[model samples]
Target: MIPVADAFRSGGAQPGQDALALTGFAAEGARAVFTVAGAEEGASGLTVHYRTQGEETATVTLLANGTEVERLALPGTAGAWDTLETGVPLRAGLNTVTLRTASGDNGAFELSGITVADAAPAPTRGAALPYTAYEAEAGTTDGTVIGPDRTYLTVPSEASGRQAVVLEETGSHVEFELTEPANALTLRHSIPDSADGTGIDATLSLYVNGEHHRDLELTSRHAWVYGEYPYTNNPAEGSPHRFFDESRVLLDEELPAGTVLRLQKDAEDTADSYTVDLLEAETAPGPGTMPDGFVDATERGVTPDDGSDDTAALNEALAQTSSEGLGLWLPPGDYHISDHVNLTGATLRGAGEWHTVLRGSDGLGGFFGRGGTSVVQDLTLDGGATVRDDAGDHAAFEGDFGSGSTLQNIWIEHSKVGLWIQSPTDGLLATGLRIRDTYADGVNLHRGTANTEVTHSSIRNTGDDGLAMWSESEAVSDSAFRFNTVQVPLLANAVGIYGGHANGVEDNVLADTVTSSAGIAISTRFSPVPFSGTTSVRRNTLLRTGGYEPNWDSAFGALWIYADTSDITAPVVVNDLEIVDSTYSGILVSWQRTVTELSVSDVEITGTGRFGIEINAAGSGTFSGVRVSGAAEGGLDLTGGFTVERGEGNSGW
Candidate 1:
């Protein structure tokens, strides 16, 4: 290991010295060169300790005998030094290394030192690794790096508890030094804002050991920077929360030790930026087990198939749990609940999904209700009683919570509504569920829900939307639907956000939605609150949508955004809303004179029964980086009043 003490010693160092000394701060076009002697050369790596003084990016080109090897994008470190490494081909005798600013800007940096070493061995991965958020605050939760115990280099002052890194321009990169080689990196990031008021649309290219590996285009629907936008009514109540687009970039090649992960923008002209909050490196598979600390429902006389009401016994068991953290386990039983079972501040688990079934009766239309800091997992909720013809509504599970409620690994079938949730609720996580054949919506989060997630689940044969987030009276902000499979919703959308702030639906597959409405729908006509938060729809595939409508002129788009004929005084401003990387069959954007600011990018329309994107919004929106083919009607059906920044690849409609 090269000591920090030895790196500061500069000037006229011997070629065979263990560490190479070089100056970092220099004017544009001025080259700072250093020499290193290789002991034996097949393939060697170079470790660099350098940093920048200001916000500008610094790029250094390395040369071996006047031949360029690679260009390394060095991240700006405000004022403190950071470390990075690169793979370089070396001759057996001597090699030359050069550094220069990437652009003609007034960029300056501090080169602490460089060292040549042998390439690292292959990685041996074991368990999935968790990386804690490294807050940019100095003395807060910013101590350890993710995999190995390493301190964070000095970060930009713009970073805070929410965003760990804030990127500005194209080709600007943020470098991370891995303590151990990581096979894959999973991180959550979001765009703060765009220059033209559209949402984020850019490709992020990854560099490993100063060599280009791969790139993935990212789009964001919300701002991670606090105070960047007027989110709430009181501007002082800026969103402290972060809505990260959870992205996993694969490293098909092994990342050796001394790896430098450089994330740089690939575009050249656009002035958009993004922020990262949390990052995790997967060394192995993720953990799957029930969380500890819970009382057994069987111990409290909640037996299986006894023809007796066990809801009271299960509730009593949850009441008897420790006050610090409430929990109860229903182990492999069909427990009947003839009355409404209400729960709060508790956790209910089971042996498995089908093993433990909670059967509901006609007197108890709503099965299990929950609120506040609760979890329901690994069980089936069977609404054995059919809905009465005169009844208003009923659900298998319903929650009206404040925060931190999760429903996981559960099955609910043959219900009027599988799960109906109204909010005061925030931070709800619903994953690993199988919900099918619902008379109404499979799951609905309406009115004041915030920061909720529904991921990795399957919902099919729903009468209404498979999943919907609506802001009837309050802002439903910062919620997400990811990696979900929705099939055959009979009446309404497969997935929809009626009106919300900074919500996202990504990486989901929707098929056989026999509705005239969009398979994926977004609208603001029904919102009681003023709508303008960023809503992102990306990386989703819709198969065979928008063939039927309940009424004429109803079923329109595969991915639809509407404002309708609402006379709401406040403009329905969807600032930085984006739909990208989606494959659709119906009309793409069904704009009905309502959307204020929007962007559509990287959209591939394979088949559209109507138009590709029909825009009639009152204000200007952009359609860039889109490709349209196999559409029956035109690519874009503009009904006037919208300005589109038509980019590239839009043809053959």
Candidate 2:
């Protein structure tokens, strides 16, 4: 299948327009290109499966390698994706296929994806095509394999077959290629359980066709490793924990044929190796079928109540769904939870964020958590009447959540942290959230998190940074924090990026910051890696940032970027950054170890605290279109030499 996400590489197609599909521009003269691979050289045809907002007929010219091959007619308006097919000439190998909008009476159209398969009649819809990896299949090995009863450990095994492959070292990898794209993949493996509290752990990162997609923790959850320890929520209380049952991982995504699935052990410090026994692929279940995998908590004797202790009930509900890839719906009620809840591959949802409330009991450590595709949506977490947990003691939501996970439309109040996301979590999306009066940061994207986005949310009255991307152990990269409102941060920066790669803080409204920290801070205080990659801070409005604290000298600044003592000897080399349209001291790049390659433009500073743009650090950058009005100091305070051009207004330099 032609991947719509890959269409953006050729231009004219919007990447990630929808979670399921991508939109290709179809305006007159607009062209969208896709790399189509053909197994055999044969007569080909172009099929356009698209969705349009209007009902005007449109024509798209299909060109193979810049030569027009076919012109397809579209029905234009369809609530769902519609198909238009036309024959085309083809050679073999990888073809450069282009779709140009030659004529569209509606001006533009949207396409989910284009298909360039053989002219053969398309197969009947909903066909059952199953691919399984049996023990008889010809399997390749990367490391030693020991398998007999159930698993193959890297160390040694008495029984050996195609079912198991073990990696003893961190760099060991096993690769397998498939002939057809898989819609879903399920794998069973053996790794130490964390609930067992065994420091032993293992992690595996996947490489599809040699491209890294996501990291999967090969370790097992604590609840499964140890018998019901106050949090397992499992009804069978006396059953002993068993390691013989392999832990299963389910992935829901489209993988093209000839896709090479590689399992590479990456975590070096964790000495424990991993064992895999069974791997299978099948046609993905359609939407709404995901919930069929779940077992309801209420069905398992969980009663919702406001006054009584509902912790055991909710815990029991979570246990049934753990590792089962199920969806749990919590009916509207005021349930009281007394402890933390860990979730995996489960969707814990409520009727609505305001309708269902989970009030924390006295001395409750934290509220809810997740580690995989477990979704927590439409729920509100109230800290109850009193908070016995101290600052940085507990977070309402905390976990090492991996890819394909989401937290949406959740309201959190009066907690140590609204959401504390640990490192190594990739592709996590947190949106439509209202978090307030937190003891610490509202949302903390810690180290090793990649491609995480927190957007369309409101964070206010935070004791520390409202929204922060901080790296400590591993590395954090390619994450975005945008379209969020942060107000009245009592301690730290409103929104800040401590250290990471390609991380951004943009289009946010920050106001009433009470401490000396700036509205937005880009620093390398505790970065896991040297601060590299492009970070953009743009279109943000900062109201009252720096001057709130009277005793503190460095109280106010709209934007601040610097490296601290924790940065060691490596000066942060920011590849590129664009700071635009921020108020107060428009942009402040200070400190000794902070060196950057920055571009400041379209910034206007109204109040006086500091210069419009201060470059006190040992770095090189450029400034343009910066204006200073009521500056207590000057417009541009360049202790370190820098270039300034296109000064739009009269200012001190």
Candidate 3:
């Protein structure tokens, strides 16, 4: 009968006591704020709820009562924020009402006792309850949806409207269609992981009457694929599932009356069998009133295309908005942008990642973020034109939120640079920001920023680097580069986290079969020298390096910490490493003036045709816990190693 969000505090003014169940908070460059919510009500128009302690201040207004009674700010601030009754239409006997605050605010409020009748009921007499309608689950279905933001759906699937539709996995997309059109509608779905995980690489999308509804993405991998992805080893600690608000495929959409809702698999994937249940649908309640909504804070399919395709819009929106408890929305369509799009504190609700179609028109990039809180997801951001030619900012999505706030769940692709960042502080928690199908860098971290972390995601198919995290300054520490899929098809020097600070590159899957600039290069000509931090290159699975391009040269694996005369005294602790199935030489450690710790343990190199450990280290270091195999030449090309105390080489060290 009662809406879930309405489960916050309900009774009269109280201390810790709450009425309904509440959740979520917005932080100012801090950890997200979450609290307990409860509510209680009486027969009169007055009702109350309880609030929890949060990191910031939050406000709560009455949904059912307001007019007659003005907002009743509690006497003093407590763990709870109260909601007083006002403008309520109270009748005799018992009554029921609801409250709402469609934002990142608390769900708790204060409930007042009732005075239904002019005169109170006789001491012994009791009053009956009034008529109240409960919420419903009518015209709706479940399942993860993926595709262009604008055109998210098509028609109903053969398995439409049966059980309950749940998550719309990202990598796995789906399509849906409508027979006719309907009124206001609400669909329920789930987002597996939240923060601290490799973000759920899944999505849920909805298409209404051939148009796109919303594209949703899994923000954190806490729930869905826990322990599924390595980089996202973010333990599912005390984190809870977060359901964000996304722009509907159609805003205040007025379908052709009798809209047919559908759910299916997205592009590049098969229809994952799911349970689809009809939630509810209805007409617009009033002006400024949002209809049914659901989203994965990571993405929303309902975005503005302007000219760029659906995906482009989604990408732009993601980089621009930090959806307040809502995901970036992008509808399906080929959005064509003429000028550069700067992102801000907006929440773009859209379809699944990599599905929203976004194409640029001019040489300018599809999306740009100078600063502020920006996030893009569930769409394709094409660099427009071809490679080598339209090369201005390969970054389909370029952001210099220098010192600004950039959070997670910003998926990008189909551009020279899927994502490029040059932030000021480390607020840019670019977790799960992937880049796919491109000619250049999937994700490039240039300019120089610190406290950045790129974890639990992948970068495949590009003419250049798959993912790079380079910063010449001391700012790039506490920064990490892990769990990525690096594959360069055209053999254009595909690398993962090239140059700059020797950030933490662990749990990544780098496969540079192409003769790219080494699998994960610390390259020959690196700027800003190197960083001074524990380059914990651990638990990575590398496959093949340097071969696709005949013109390409040397290729390295796990790490290529190259920087001469640069004070990079920090050790390169390569542990739990596995370098199997490569095309060229296993690893080549080159020119380095600074002598730091280079402990290689648990190193396994199998199926390599060339020398396994070609250590050209002029600096002093130790090679321990190393394992190599299938090397025609001697395994360790030890040129100037400080010590080879303990090692296991098949041929020689």
Quick one: best TM-score, which candidate? 2
Off by over 4 Å in 3: 1-27, 32-329, 389-394, 402-413, 431-434, 473-475, 489-502, 546-559, 565-567, 592-595, 647-653
Mark the 10 consecutive residues where model 3 has the least summed lDDT. Answer: 150-159
Better of 2 and 3 by TM-score: 2
* Ranking of all candidate structures by their lDDT, best first: 2, 1, 3
Clashing pairs in 2: 147-159, 148-159, 195-222, 424-448, 448-475, 516-555, 546-555, 546-556, 546-557, 547-556
Winner by lDDT between candidate 2 and candidate 1: 2
Off by over 4 Å in 2: 1-296, 322-325, 363-370, 385-392, 548-552, 566-584, 640-653
Per-model TM-score versus the true fold: 0.53, 0.55, 0.52
Best by the lDDT measure: 2
Backbone-clash count (model 3): 157
Encode model 2's per-residue lDDT on 181-213: one tens digit a residue: 675554545565443343234556777777876
TM-score of candidate 2 on Cα atoms, chains taken together:
0.55
In candidate 1, stretches whose alpha carbon ends up further than 4 angstroms from where it belongs are 1-292, 322-326, 362-370, 385-393, 525-528, 565-585, 588-592
Error of 2 at 440 (Å): 0.7
Candidate 2, poorest ten consecutive residues by summed lDDT: 150-159
RMSD of 2: 25.0
What local lDDT does model 1 show for residue 625?
A: 57
